[model samples]
Target: MTVSPRNLRALWPLAPCACTALLCLCPALRGRGAEDGAGCGPLLKGSALLLAAGAGPPTLLVRPRSDYVCCHLALAVRLVPALPLGDALYLVPARQALWALDASKPEQRLLAWLRQQAPPDSCHLKCLQILKGLRDLSGRGLEGPLGAQWGRVLSSYALKTALFSVLLRGPWQAWQEQFLVERLEELVLYLRDCLRKRVLMHFFLGNPHVPEAVPVPRFLREAAPLNLLAAFDAATLDAAATQLLAAWSQAPKIIRMYSGPRHLRRSPALCRHVPEASQEAQSD
Candidate 1:
């Protein structure tokens, strides 16, 4: 059967999910080190070592390596325990003046340590306040050693924003579909790249407390909030399915190495496109 370019283009949004399914369907074609039972023990061990080094006694006072490592650990921890609840909670503070603390001053170190001890749920708000304070202090030309500290705060906020976008929005869903499939295709590609980067970072540098092997099913379950499957109708889903199948045909072997073989098989029957199916069914 000949599939037209247009037909294939129409199926692109479902590429991520379809690729997932394909991995499940062809177990024998799996690459080396693709064994399903592989443990992430090695990866976790490395992360633990990094964490100990990063969190160990303050040896070099000049660079603030402890601060940087702690921040990354905090980000990693957030990914597993909490869902990005909403955009409002993730917003950066309007005032960036509260972060101005003298690095050399004992009081400043005390303040920073206190802020660090704040509960994770309250960290966002406390961090925002610190940033605003720093920005204001910087304005007055009194920031001194806290300059680098302010930069770290801002960088953390930026990372949080990017992570929030991924968690709250589906990787396959687009801000605009009417313009062309190109934009949506770009989104799929971008999400895939983002996922790859995150996985690699976690694999290489993540904390030891984190699990070594993140099973494909477990990852998908965590990613369910961002899958975009809940948002489509049968017609849209079908179009997505077609695009995904084509995309999978061209996916790199490494990308398909994570999951089991059964994931690739489509349902025995195709879905019907009823725009109101979810709403009507819910009301019934």
Candidate 2:
């Protein structure tokens, strides 16, 4: 499958959907196209650049509050089964940013913000790619249910939050040193903790805390300690994780064959431009 990376902003029209804002991987994922103003200081920000940057700009900066600016985008994903995709939220420490007041509209850019933040960090990217590989290994079993069926639970959003929380709580470098299999187990265990608490907080700043300034859906706010992952029981949840691991042991060769290339181990995008990428290419 040779498919170019389509900006999530452009997608075929479908029924509207809502997904929670869960912080995923690292920020370095923003490639050359993205102009990250690390040295710009407070006076100048990337979001502010979005306006002067021109239309169809790769990213738009949304400054909802004074302290930080969230690089916002109109992002939507086309999944196999049709569903309403939601917004994403990201907190960049510096920048004057862009201005927009569509308060009348619902907030749905959390995923977009997440998609942007993830994959740039080598540590977070390393773990996510392996987990995603496991998911692909399991015949795409990772997305348990996007709230379509009874006892429906699990999605990339929740997993991202859990992964972020795990990486934040511990030293990311050491976490990366563990064998690939061990890292995957840690992810499953981390999700178990989120399932236990029934709460998944956004970790854009590398923490499990969600500041009041960040916008969240009414349910996310009112729900309090409980997260969207509260829908499943222990048995089914355990079964899902166990089954995924089992699949790996059941067929190592086949899973590795279908699994993504090592070069993209730290990239969440998963799209490999080349027809075949050897292990040597992965290390580069």
**Local distance difference test scores for all models:** 0.29, 0.40
| Candidate 2 weakest lDDT stretch, 10 residues | 18-27
lDDT score of model 2?
Answer: 0.40
The worst-scoring run of ten residues by lDDT in candidate 1 lies at 75-84
**TM match of model 2 to true structure:** 0.38
Model 2: per-residue Cα lDDT over 17-58, one tens digit each: 211111122122233333653543343443333322433322
Model 2: residue 55 alpha-carbon error in angstroms: 31
User: How many steric clashes between backbone atoms does each model show?
Assistant: 29, 17
On the 0 to 100 scale, the lDDT of residue 85 in model 2 is 31
Superposition error at 265 for model 2 (Å):
16
Candidate 1 segments whose C-alpha is farther than 4 A from its true place: 1-231, 253-284
| Model 1: per-residue Cα lDDT over 77-139, one tens digit each | 101111111211111112221111111122233234433443333222322333233233333
Candidate 1: residue 230 Cα off by (Å): 5.6
**Candidate 2, residue 232: CA error in Å?**
2.3
